[model samples]
Target: MDSTIRTAIAAADGDDPYRALRQLHHARIELTRELDRAEALAVRRARTAGASWQVIAMALEVSKQAVHKKYGRG
Candidate 1:
């Protein structure tokens, strides 16, 4: 994981384990959302660069249909 993320997690709610855990979970969810946004941007860029859905899907380790289903339309 990134050092900044680690630092943020470590700094959160040091007083209680349950609070720390909840903070960590929230941090993870935020990171997951960021990753999803980045992935969608990559897909959009690939499409704009003239890459086929099959190629993008294969690069992402998913089926072409899956990629299209997720990111094909505007």
Candidate 2:
């Protein structure tokens, strides 16, 4: 996996493991939220640049319908 994630897991496994685990969980949640925002921005930019949902879905390894449902305006 990612070196950063590995480091976090290692730190979480050290002394005071419970506190470390909570820290790791919080970090993961923040990272996930950031990723979601980034993805939404990327999808909007792609749409503005004339990319079709089918193309976006292919790149994301998901269905066009799924991509559209998640990122579509209406």
Candidate 3:
């Protein structure tokens, strides 16, 4: 079990934990940004396809105002 813990905690690259941690965090940020872009594109497509703000909001599980506030101007 100790070996499992060690492996889980081990630096992915050499013994530089900081570099490994930074890489992981950067990857997460990049993925989040990519997802946001994809979501925005999807919203645009939906809007172009005659989907209402309320409908989009419901699909996104957010309020109409919230969805409009986020993407209406764009």
Candidate 4:
């Protein structure tokens, strides 16, 4: 997906193992932040399109209460 994530998976390895590990750690943080933003945006769009919290939760594999708590009613 993202170049940083792709690099983490495909290239962040073993020339100098310690340095690669550090780069991978940072990439993981970046990837998690990106994913959180993306998930938030998707939830917004889904809600706009009249999706129920239960439907969204089903798609996300979380409980309805968890999704509602995380995104709230809008």
lDDT of each: 0.86, 0.85, 0.80, 0.87
Candidate 3 residues lying further than 4 Å off, grouped into runs, are: 1-14
> Sorted on TM-score, highest at the top, how do the candidates line up?
2, 4, 1, 3
Name the best candidate (by TM-score). 2
Instruction: Give one digit per residue, the lDDT tens place, for model 1 in 1-74.
Output: 47646855885748777877776777788789889999999999999999999999999999999999999885
Please, what are the lDDT tens digits per residue for candidate 3 over residues 1-74? 34433444454655888876766666666667878999999999999999999999999999999999999985
lDDT per residue (tens digit) for residues 1-74 in model 2: 25556667788768888877876887787778888998899998999999999999998899999999999978
Candidate 2 residue runs with Cα over 4 Å from true position: 1-10
Please report how far candidate 1 places residue 62 from its true position, in Å. 0.8
Stretches off by above 4 angstroms in model 4 are: 9-12
lDDT of 3: 0.80
lDDT of 4: 0.87
| lDDT per residue (tens digit) for residues 1-74 in model 4 | 47876776665555777777777898989878888999999999999999999999999999999999999965
RMSD to true structure for each model, in Å: 3.0, 3.2, 7.2, 2.2
For model 1, the local distance difference test gives: 0.86
Extract clashing residue pairs from model 4: none
Cα lDDT for residue 3, candidate 4: 80
